[model samples]
Target: DTSRPTDLQRLIDGIIDDLIALEAPISGFFEDVDQLKRLRHSEANDYYQQVYGLEQRRQAYLSRLRTQFVTRLGIRTEQLMRENEQRRESIRRTTYGRVEDCIQWVRSRLEKLSAMEFVEDLEQLEGMFEEHKVDNHEIQDFRQNVDESIARQ
Candidate 1:
């Protein structure tokens, strides 16, 4: 009976040792899985941060390009405005010079004409009129000619 008890105690101790051995490997497997999960989470975080950085850089580059384009457009517009003003001033000067020349030519022609010739021209103009009824069309044509000459100047 003493031998039987010793055999039973030895069998129970062996079973306990087997259970501890199995638990050691199982616990190690759980630890390995936890470590893998942490690593995967860290990798995902790093990838997201990289993508965010790239997006920020892209936005900055586009903003700079937009600013450069706007600045160039403004400069071009100012140059065009200056050229337009210069052209207008040149046209004004040319028109002024032409009007001055026309005035001088009229004064010279009036100075060259004798008083008798001027009176004779006036008499001829009166003779062409019909009994105090002047032709409105002829007057309009003369006015249009004067207007055209001034415009040409």
Candidate 2:
């Protein structure tokens, strides 16, 4: 929070401390250059480890983000598909109801209606059924009845 040093501030403070320690004379005069080399090498190794750890954390974050996104997308897609299927079924039922009602209306007036009017109504009903890709056994039976009535007439 406000009391704690930010990561950047902490890094800056750490570097200042490291520089002071590195400048301090370990020996009386002109200390071994090898000791200096080793110190710098250790610092570089520590930085590399830090960078590697940050990289691993970055990769893990991305993996988790991708998984969550895919899961949400899949859930949404499945929900839409279910909605689409329900609408399709509702339309199917409605189409069948309309076709059935029309067939009944035509059959009620079949004897009184002229052959032309009966044929027109049947064609309209057939078109509705065909448009919805349906196969109604009643339609076929009605067709036979129409044919027999026309022949009798």
* lDDT score for residue 18 of model 2: 47
User: How well does model 1 score by local distance difference test?
Assistant: 0.46
Off by over 4 Å in 1: 1-76, 114-153
- Per-model TM-score, in order, reads 0.29, 0.25
Cα deviation of 136, candidate 1, in Å: 21
User: Could you give candidate 1's per-residue lDDT for residues 1-153 as a string of tens digits?
Assistant: 345545644554455345434434543543454354345444543443354354344434433433454343332346435634664565466557646655675565456443324335767768645422433433443343345346534
Question: Candidate 1, after superposition: displacement of residue 52 in Å?
Answer: 64
Clashes of each: 0, 0
Q: At residue 93, give the lDDT of candidate 1.
A: 68
